[model samples]
Target: MTILNETATRTDRWTPVCSYTDLLPERGAAVLVGTMQVAVFRTFDGALYALGNFDPFSGAYVLSRGIVGTRGGEPTVASPMHKQVFSLVTGVCVDDPAVAVPTYPIRVTDGTVEVSVV
Candidate 1:
């Protein structure tokens, strides 16, 4: 998996996952990017985030089903299997900053939530 940074890079051919309207507020959506399973989230504030759906610790496919909350206003998601907390924006483990998760850059263009997989 890769954590692409569109803000610093170019992705003119990003793949579309879902309409921005399709995402549940404060919920995460599991999507496919060329066979890679991903968890794309729409925060309560309307911000979008994307990360690998697989939990590195438990090897579970539950990041999409994880809980959403904040710590001192930093948005986060908890792993359902072991309750590992990770920053939605950076995909960095809050409990242990050394741990990293691939965080993809996302955008909503014309109501579509698109992500770069290249």
Candidate 2:
């Protein structure tokens, strides 16, 4: 008999990255998932977010090292190279709407943080 639930099956697509408490509030961490570099962030409100670690402005994988903050009530991270702010939720550049980065799906499971590239 199968005791697994639907949620458990869904979690198969999620890749565990780190513990929920490992992430400092308003800071970002970089993780590699299947050849993809992902930047994970945790807001002061205990919210988790993930975005591509590549910074379009500087053509560098330093988004994870950017400064975390907010803009217009939206969680944001500014590129450390050029200081371009990007929305953590949508991965859109707040300074330039025409340009945007990629966002990934992130979640917390049993105190562990997970990011899905697929």
- Residue 25 of candidate 2: its Cα lDDT? 92
> Candidate 1 on 86-112: residue-level lDDT in tens?
999789989888986888778877778
Candidate 2 residue-wise lDDT, 26-105, digit = tens: 89999998899999998888888889999998999999999998899999999999999999988899999999998877
lDDT of each: 0.82, 0.84
Model 2 steric clash total: 0
- Residue pairs of candidate 1 with colliding backbone atoms: none
TM-score of each: 0.89, 0.89
Clashes of each: 0, 0
Worst 10 residues of 2 by lDDT: 1-10
lDDT, candidate 1, equals: 0.82
